[model samples]
Target: MMNCIEAHGLTKQFAGRLALNNVDLTVGSGRIVGIMGPNGAGKTTLLKAILGLTPFGGELKVLGRDPWVSRDALMNDVSFVADVAVLPRWMRVSQAIDYMNGVHPKFERAMAEGFLSKTTIGREQKVSQLSKGMVAQLHLALAMAIDAKLLVLDEPTLGLDIAYRTQFFESLLHDYYDKARTVIVSTHDIDELQHVLTDAVFMDGGRVVFSCDMTDFDAHFHEVAVKPSDHELARTLNPLHERHSFDRSVFLYRNADVEKLATLGEIRTPRLSEVYLATISNQTLAQKGSPK
Candidate 1:
């Protein structure tokens, strides 16, 4: 598969403090990748770098062009949606469509109108009159109508209610996704977002701590529900993480003997949320033990 985005030794610093540190990442075509991390972990910085919104050091390319040097041309093949949609307050729904049609050569006005037809938003409704959810709908309709090769979303559903959030994702998967388009989404909603991801990357301290394709994740990680008598035995295998639930305990392991784990207790594939927590926990431990 051809790579849509590639970076090696990518470094970015803000006021002498590192935001992205020697990062190496590659995103191939037709992928739905999720970027997760705690605050200040460089998730946003990485996304910005991909979108050519921030200056950084080292080799970085999006669609085979240096992002920093060719950002204006890059914008033609890229579309972005931030947590907050900032449309012109005085522009009506119809005008927004017209504005996008005039600026983006790839935007399909009929397609945008078709998407809006499913929503309650009226053509005469001004941006200021629409609710937050409506604004998100408008933003999504506009963005999805474009024939961009890469779509970047940063906290696309930050403040919406559960209904809106669920609807937003459903619309994205059912309407916008295809084998020709690549998507990169940055959000903290791991549990809700995991299902849509073809790959996931967990970052900490401005670096990638863990990354895996969803299909291969199971082979590399496992979890076992251990009986009280087997807890000690399970610990002997050096489980990556362990958690208790009143009378039962689950131990997360990486590259352990499946047969041995099965003998210890019930073995199953771990959830993305579980693996992500374990990755972050282990990263913290490693940092604490590193030399000053």
Candidate 2:
């Protein structure tokens, strides 16, 4: 597959401290990859670097052209919906649609308006008057209408409620994702987006600590529960992470025979949130995933 976005030896500095250190990433065409990390983990920094919103040290290519030097040309084929609900406040929804049409050659005005109808937004309403979730929906609808080869979304569902967030991603997959296009999403809602994510990247303190295909997410992590009596036995297996409920405790472990787990109670697939806790633990980082 062709690379839609590539970063090599990327580094960024803030007050003499490194935000990103020799970071490298490859996003192939037509893949929905998620960049996951805690707050202040350089997730937005990487997006900004890719969007040419900030100057950073390294090589970046979007659609085979340098993003920093080729921002104008690159933006013609790349679109972004940042985490911030920063729609044009004074513009009416219709006016914003019109502006998008004028700026993006392939903007689909009709589709955008149609998509907006799925929400409660009135076409005549000013952006400033819309609620936060409404703003997210508006941006989502507009981004979906772009015919860009690459779409970069930062915290794409930030203010959305459950229904809108669910509908937004479904619409994104149906309308925007295709073999010739790419979608890169940054979000904290791992559980919601896990289903559609093709790959996952975990960053910390401006550096990538974990990168893996999401298909392997289910393969490598397992969620299990054990009876109080079997707690010591479960711990002996070196569970990746563990938590306690009332009478039973939950754990995330790697390939600890299910037969052995039968004594522990119910075993199930660890959710994205559970996997996150297991993999992103302080001990895991300090011991296994260290460049710190």
Best by lDDT: 1
lDDT of each: 0.90, 0.83
Model 2, residue 206: what's the lDDT?
79
Q: Which pairs clash inside model 1?
A: none
Best by TM-score: 1
**What is the Å distance of residue 37 in model 2 from its true position?**
1.4
| Model 2 per-residue lDDT tens digits across residues 82-188 | 86466778989999899999888879999898888878999999989988778887888888888899899999788778987887788888866887888898999
Off by over 4 Å in 2: 228-236, 255-266, 283-292
Worst 10 residues of 1 by lDDT: 80-89
TM-score computed on alpha carbons, candidate 1: 0.95
How much is 158 displaced in model 2, in angstroms? 1.6
